[model samples]
Target: ARRRLYPKPFPGIPYNKVSANRIAGDLPELIPVIKATNEYSTSMFAISTQRLRLPLAQDPREIEDILVRRGREFDRAPMSIKTLKNFFPYSFMGKYNTPEVKEQKRIWADAFGADFLRKVAAPSIYNATLDLADGRPFEVVEDLHNATLDAIWVALVGEEAGITRHEIKKFLQSQRDASDGGRRDPGPPPRGYLLRREVDYVSEMIAKNSSSGIPVLAQKLAAYLPRHRQFRRTVDTEIGLVMRKAVDRFQRLELGRLEAGENDTCMMDLVLRRKVLEAKKLGRPLMDPTKDKVLLDDTFLMMFASYPTAQTELRAALKVAFPHPTTPSVDELLGADIPYLDAACEESLRLAGVAKGNLRQTVVDTHIMGHFVPKGAEIFMNYHVDHAPYPVDEEKRSASSQAAGAKLAAREGISRGDVSRDLGSFEPRRWLVKDEKTGQEVFDAYALPQLAFGGGYRGCSGRKLAVMEFRTVVALLVLNLEFLELPEEMKTLKASETIFRLPDMPFASLRAL
Candidate 1:
């Protein structure tokens, strides 16, 4: 057990394997443990057994030390590789530290760079905004997912890649359905009708495993049972077909550009051009087959990881920004300094972290937070643990007008923010501060430690792109509509189907301003 191997020298959650397993689902049960270790115990602690030794790093500085300052001494954790490979067949998410991963990072940097934003992403987003403004009951969730889909297609393959086909669209939706936190209606998959049984099982596997990390041994152990072995055998084939189709489509689109002798301003053009330049430098005909795999996987994962997170964040922003009904022009959106909106986005990310934390494997006997972590120790940056807002005491809550007065006014048949009546998630004042010297308002950014996007060189290169999309679309939505809260029973959209803290968006209907 963890307590036995870790010794008494370092403090941690009292490791009971039964309790540890239960903590996987019992969120209420887990928070106090996280709160205690981070706020009450040491900066970092361990949960170790003979098979696994995980250092739960809660100090932002210690997390920064692992992710940013000392990133070179770590690699993508084995847990990520073991769990995510099926979905990320050709991407960096599941890859370890290697020359190839470093090279892939470069390609991703160039592919998702600013030019890609201006030429490919922004225009698509602006157009989606315009389309979304057509006065229909938009399922804010699904529409956002589709818009990101279209944007990624444009960025990666060029709009000319001809994704307008129904089959391809269905394929995209299939991926979306599988990751939407549950099973689809029992029926045929979008494609591969004959393999419906296998495809459904694969979808189940992806939907089940997408949000959590399953240790490789645990996965193998599951296969030794009956139903899981069927899943193991069929999942590879079903998922393989999807991967092959994706790779084939990418190859086709790139080859078409080659045959036409014309290049569109998209990621494919940039990537292929980089490949050509590299091949010439190396005096070879083309890039390595492996490098090509990077481009294929990178583009897909780029879309998948982002689209859902963007939609969830938009819902979060709407929870705050949609009440104002101030539609900024796209140009105004791009130009003006809307620090409050930016603050709301940051707050949403902090409150509903897209990922619980990131994983890193120690590459050597390393000194992290003054403790020597043995080589091969896996480090988990528990962002929830880190971002657990230092609690506000009941006395403090009762004293503040923001908390107590709102509750008291509702019971007394008085309006919370006066009878003028507008709906927003929480008072925006809680997030703002006036800068005396600059005479401008800015977010109280460090009110909490935010690790929504992980830190370091390994941090998301797509951060800029994702932020732009969030700012542009949510800003536009605020311009075009007003957000009203659902019924008291349907007050929040946050879901429990997964650990990723995404929203169910229940009864989250919108109204035209």
Candidate 2:
């Protein structure tokens, strides 16, 4: 009767037999794993009776099948949608492949288009990075995070956020105020420095939200906790700031006060301008920015999601690319021929491993890595472990995937196993290939199994924008400054995950080139 009353693992799949007997199933075992890794790292352990689990996919070929080819078999996990919807209701992050999501994507499609990225986003990112070349031994992670915030803010609102600039000004002031003529490295700025209250609040809330796997329950319980209550209040205040910026852009469009060229408008102006055009075409009234929940929600989501990944990956890229601080001009760094820099960035992205994996739900009963997944079962494509040197159980993979894997293995520079031994190290040359037409080596994205930005329709929509921002920041910094070698105590690679994976020790001792 208990077997029927409580959930149990599907028949013929691997599971903890002892967990099946308990009402909590895998909760007892799962907590420890989450505590250690900030993620579910129980590869192939399907002990979660709440849902049939395929913990992590060790094979990249099968990952491609699940994310791309077999879309009918797997899709965005329902639990993921449920959890994220509370925070990002109108954003694509929380939605399935429906008409609404398609429309949302279409409306904002040009935001990341090549022309917009080059003319609008790139300049904004370049301007933001200008404040960082002061040659102080600043906290690399925090400063970069602020720089990203500034860049994204300018892209979204068509004005300077001055976040990084403000921090720099404060840092300079702090140094000047010191009795010893500011010669000492005072380390990263104190918490709540100037406009960082909102940033800290967002981080605190996300960390608290993810700490308990059950976000919805945790959200409800948050109302009673004093710290959480403050976080909610601050987040709400931040939302007001975002909404007001939208309102300002909307009013400017309505009043024909666009100071920049039509093509150079901020992301908010682009959306509002399109909306105005659409309303005029349909003979409807102009939509209010305050009333359009989709507009407000997606803008908020973009601000929160854009920065952390680039900052983390940039740290990894810098560590790999510039060991002795040889500088290049900005033109050389951003030119088409910098294959080494490009390769280093790709390698760092692979090593950063911000997300543990992406979750997918089975649309119908299907096979993954030769195991039977029941309809509605959830599976995690464990890119984090797959990028590592985990042994692939080839016999367990489906025949079609096996054929695909075999075909990839036959090609030189295609198979991941070719460089399996060096997977853990930072080697950029692995991603470089001699271009037959140009007779010059170039970074080949396909050289490695690419899952950093994810794949298919449900993949990260802002990937292009993120990459552009990352490359621009990395190039500017690498060209203009020399990142000095850190002391042993400051070289720790420990990271903490919340909204995104972030380095715990993100300092960069530097000198002006």
Candidate 3:
């Protein structure tokens, strides 16, 4: 049994010999530790201990095989989102592979489908960017989040809803309350804060109940923790408000459409109308519209995931956007001829590494990459590890060749040292190149195209909407704004790792066009 369960750890110190925490605190480069200990191992490894097994599908082929080919054989780690239930006793995030989840996913996918999203959001996004032409330096993250919040909320949530009018302060404050065990004061949130419902909704869900032991079990026990008590209040209050507002607006829209014989669809209206139909057939009173569970829950899930991922990608794009050589004008960027801008978006997501990986579970005992993974074991499908760019071919990087080049340069009166381009650097041009002969646009696909958005059947449902929003918003901002490099002092910004990689407190500023 021990042999079957452990399958020999991937050549690392025994769990008892060294601690994961100590290694994190004491070691500056844990990647070196991984390289040394798990040197040649691939696919799966216990790394530290039998109880701490981590399956790494590092190769793109293996990633495709697992996440795409054999995706059904696995499920997202069951406990990965169990903590979400504290907010909605039945958060669809905590449940998976059910008919309800499927139904909700279908609805969400349709609502965020490319056509539906663009029709609703294109004009607003264009106008939002144009609004930023004041030339004063403003916080880019804050502005982006606010604009993203409004765009999504108005399009998906309600026609009248706007980000500035939403209780943005409450959500941000609530998130702080939830994560820190209510250690911070439960102070009153400011009114009319920007980035309201969308921000708070996701933030509260993000707060993990404190624990040091096995994460799955620790999270399971997190809700009963005292800190969650305060956080729950924030969640309950906001859920009530969002649900009330969504339902109220949905009814009015449906009534108007029916009366005027018009065919219009807002996101929530579809779900509500479906519920009403189900109720009429089943002889029940539309069964607590919000209690359909998946409808509201899934909206929250998509919004929660969508907004932050958009923020990360947008912020990353801002870092590379122009007041410089790579800049394009509004017409040029929007004209569909800008391959470099498109490549820049892709590269930004890859480098941001926002979602490092997903945690999946082996549904039954299975064999992968020659390792025996038993039923219920966890698999860490790491995007960061699998998305690595390969080292430069040594033959092309020979020391003799480099020395000769240096000598040639010296003789030419430009004594520059051998320039080694870091393959791992953020090079947007990796995605495209100008054709040498015809100068036509051509794709120079990354050697290993980044799967920052997980690749598989369970690929992001919100991806279409996210793409549209990111492309439109980032491009508009880039066309008009400039992101200044941070001062050395401000550069001290630390990243707070979560399900997403978030800047702890980024102070990036943007100037108007």
Give each model's whole-structure lDDT: 0.53, 0.65, 0.52
| Candidate 3, residue 396: how far the Cα is off, in Å | 27
TM-scores for candidates 1 onward, in order: 0.64, 0.82, 0.67
Worst 10 residues of 1 by lDDT: 414-423
How good is model 2 by TM-score? 0.82
Candidate 1 off by > 4 Å: 1-14, 17-52, 160-207, 210-214, 217-264, 280-283, 287-291, 310-329, 366-372, 385-431, 443-447, 497-499
lDDT tens readout by residue for model 2, 246-304: 55545445324332336445777677666766665577887666567787667767777
State the lDDT of candidate 1 residue by residue for 200-255, as single tens digits.
34334544543223435554454456765564444444334444443344444444
| Residue 258 displacement (Å), model 2 | 11
Residue pair clashes in candidate 3: 168-196, 171-200
Judge candidate 3 against the unseen true structure and give its global Cα lDDT, from 0 to 1: 0.52
Of the candidates shown, which would achieve the greatest lDDT relative to the real structure?
2
Assess the local accuracy of residue 394 in candidate 1 as a C-alpha lDDT between 0 and 100: 36
Give the candidates in order of TM-score, highest first.
2, 3, 1
Poorest stretch of ten by lDDT in candidate 3: 37-46
Model 1 C-alpha lDDT versus the unseen true structure:
0.53
Per-residue alpha-carbon lDDT of candidate 3 for residues 452-486, written as tens digits (9 for 90 to 100): 77766577766666666667666766555667666
Model 3 TM-score relative to the real fold: 0.67
